[model samples]
Target: MTKCLGLVAVLAALGFATQASANQDVQTLASDPANWAIQSGDYSGHRYSKLDQINASNVGDLRVAWTFSTGVLRGHEGGPLVIGDVMYLVTPFPNVVMALDLAHEQKILWKYQPKQDPFAAAVMCCDTVDRGVQYAEGKILVHTADTSLIALDAKTGMEIWKVKEDDPKNGASGTGAPLVVKDKVIVGVSGGEFGVRCYITAYDLNSGHRVWRAYSMGPDADMLIDPDKTTSLGKPVGKDSSLKTWNGDQWKIGGGPVWGYMAFDPALNLVYYGSGNPSTWNPVQRAGPGGKRIDQKWSQTIFARDADTGIAKWVYQMTPFDEWDYDGVNEPILTDLDIDGVKRKALTHFDRNGFGYTLDRVTGELLVAEKFEPDVNWATKVVTDKSDPQYGRPLINKKFSPFETGTDDVTKGICPSSMGAKNQQPAAYSPLTSLFYVPVTRLCMDMEAFKVSYQVGQPYVGATLTMFPAPGENGNTGAFIAWDGAKGKTVWSKPERFAVWSGALTTAGGIVFYGTLEGYLKAVDQKTGKELFKFKTPSGIVGNPMTYMHDGKQYVAVLSGVGGWAGIGLAAGLTDPEDGSGAVGGFASLSSYTGLGGTLTVFALP
Candidate 1:
């Protein structure tokens, strides 16, 4: 099971590596607003659309325009890829890719399913999930559950070229979507819970050639970091940047499975992504001599790298010596914000650590970091201004620090839980409203960490915990809120009885749409958190909402199937409410609300 293929894709750090030569066709298609040409819809990672035919004023009149079933009953995360008259969709394990003829009443034009090892699904930390696909250079890029990155002809669904990015034997899997940076397809894997060293690799988009691969933690050459030129918080990080902080070779199995969404800046020639958490959730096991915190270098960090060379420009580590398994791998929404009368290129992120951070994307300067959830108690506040010596660090509350309490000390009343304030359910940024619509979990946990050894292809997690709704907000488990990243403040909040595990989508129509675990797709006013429309889908939803223009009409689409970490109990047919560690124990009520289902429900005005 210990397949040493060499990688270090640790969790959510928002590293930067974007379009090198600029795929002109994808650039034009994404710019036209007629097609969702990329996995994140655009490089900005806004998850927002310009189509407004179905505005808030008439969204109530919207009806089901079309629907298609993937025939796979598992969690559906990302939305479909609608490029012109063709639409592309992917499913959970044994990854299946289907090209649908949008003009021909949603006819199945072609389908390609990979024959994968069943063991891949068996070893996943949570449940099997593939975040759809990405499109570039007339090819559909697929990151399969078995760690295979393949390219299929967009029109025929025929295999163009394929590469084994990582071996499943080592517990490596690719759940997040691959990103196309010009001619290079950048990919990251998820297996942090399996205790595998992780990294991001860039392959040529057309030829499937390995361009450059960078590890999350290790030697400077291995990470492609320039000791003198590469920086941390605007200062150069000298040689042995990663090795110095780690205790011996512990960084080798230190999980860096960065399986989250990525963003790019064409002008900066940078690719952005977040790395995963360190391995062995028990901080006591990862401690240095004399019980000092092991600052596992590069894990739980955000990075900006030169797209072509894959060298780090700058990096900022959040949740250093992480004790709560807070991965830095959230979606980094890039936008230009005028802060203090100065227009700055900004990247805003809603972290699993329960903080909304906005940083200067160009220089990696810390701009704003504030708790989106008021009840978040792990940290008091982040020092935002560079003037302070403690800038960019969260002031930890020792009362909730698992590492502080040591091994076997059951830490109670930790807000946000290890599920974080949010999961992969991405938020949306609307320029019109200048706000971020976030769909998030509102649960607290009681956790106990024990020493655990790293075993490849097996869960290396050392924490066992149970979850319940957080205190305040009437004991609700989820909420949809509007946030102003520029000011690091919440604009409004709307509570949900269950977790809002679905992604949010905002449109020029002035509405933000998100789905609830109860199967209700709710469209609300963008400015205010007022509900505008709600429709029940066939099952609970964990998919992101997307919009596209077809035949001069605007349409919105989302996939409904409940089987992510939050719905693993029903999807995996597990009777134990405590299965998946505590996932079932936390979200066991979801089984009573909806059963397993897999269907794409598209909405449009009649």
Candidate 2:
């Protein structure tokens, strides 16, 4: 008995029960296609895996290996983390964490469930959707809907540390995943509609102590902007960049939430993320000059900050004086591309504003920008000239500018609904083909601007929108397209009956995988855009797909659920009219296809 006890202690000390060591050289394993260690698969946010065992030739033989019901009836938007013999899965709302032993008939290792406030659900703008959790240094990190950042022992599922990052009572909730960059666990909040002053906070991975805090809208100090040092368009942000942009104390209620995934550059030591739109979609109430004011300095912009210290490196506003709710919260993918015979380090982003931008990652230089879809009439192009460096201004169609249109009531037939062309769903980059596969919506809306006053923690939006399919698109509402970011061109596109609401996954097997609002997990040939395989999932899929190898076999997994802004009206059973709050009448078609559900499905070549 004494010898057995001593052996057990030694095993615990060695972290044998955990099965996977987060201490493993992360940089090495992260790049490995056989292992999925990070949320976006790797720091680059490419969402591309190098595994070819499940290549295009044999993809048609794929079959379901297993499926697990999360038992949480909400949208699931992120994939699982498979490390060695164990897999970690996180569900919505209650934020339950489950560990599965993959080696033995999917044995349940342990589960960690948190007791959460039910009120948080009511405050969430959309159905509670948790992007995912992170694992590092023998701990699993998760951001809860009730505004808590928690760390759990990977082996025992015991709580290691928990910290309150946001207050749900004040209309702030957390749905974005926490990113672990070395010793820092970075998190952000979601409340653009709730009027909560949002910020991104980083905590020490070991102690859970706050290291730095950066607000999305505030003075230079609170925003961590250095007047002479922080810059955008190769120019300094100047004194009080964020403060000068707003009227009075409006910046306090300004809505610039960080509710999406972030990408990191280890070599540059910088992390990049985009902020949400300004408060009250009606820009008339927010005041400020229309175009080229630089006052909307930080909101609706892409920020580059020092990963270690949270100091601003540079920024680029995708939408200036955001009249449309075009939040720049999509994932910014990093890659190297050859443009005009020169290899350039490129950061490609697909904005909700219907434009695909490719910029120099290191210097924040705008290289190429183009409308990704033909229905994008709001902005003709992005203007980055030296004299008028309105990142996305000068090109915003004057006819669609809600502020310029003199009509007090409704500006009819605006292409690309307030939801923009894409939401939080991530695109994929395939190094093998040098193309990006994007899932985008072809939705347009008729919007009416109104007057509203801000009240703390209450919905401050001042707009009524009615959405519908873009005209002249053959009644199709979405498409999956292959883009050449280096040249700002679309290679090929395949239309879908509904919005393509899934994060894209590309593989060395020459296949691109994604999910649909109608419950189909599909794989298309990476080079030819031909449908190779698809499986009907249990529910609509708004989640990302990931690939990993266990026991020498490649496996693909994805979260299947339906509850984003696109389907919120249906999932929540709201009685909105044909032209009401969320345009539930516009999205009524989704009800015929799939309802709310939460399931994790895995597939492998049989």
Best by lDDT: 1
Clashes of each: 36, 1
C-alpha lDDT values of all predictions: 0.87, 0.85
In model 2, what are the clashing residue pairs, if there are any? 245-295
Question: Candidate 1: lDDT of 395?
Answer: 90
Runs with alpha carbons beyond 4 Å of true place in candidate 2: 1-25, 289-294, 387-394, 406-408, 578-580
lDDT of 1 by residue, 1-606 (tens): 223322212211233323334666677788878788876778889988888898989999889998999999988888799988999999988779999999988999999999788888877777788887998878999999888999999989899999998888998988989988878999988889988899999999889999999999999999999999998888888898988888888888989778889998887878899998998888889888788976788998898989899999999888888889889998899999988789999999999999998889988898889999887999999988688898888899999989888788899999888888988889999999889999989888888999888777788999888888888768679999999998889999999988899999888899999998878888999998889999999999999888899989999899999888888887898867557767787887787789889999999999
Residue 149 displacement in candidate 1 (angstroms): 0.3
Best by TM-score: 1
Candidate 2: C-alpha lDDT: 0.85
Give the Å error, residue 191, model 1: 0.9
Where's the lowest-lDDT run of ten residues in candidate 1?
Answer: 4-13
Question: What TM-score number comes out for model 2?
Answer: 0.93
User: How displaced is residue 215 in candidate 2, in Å?
Assistant: 1.0
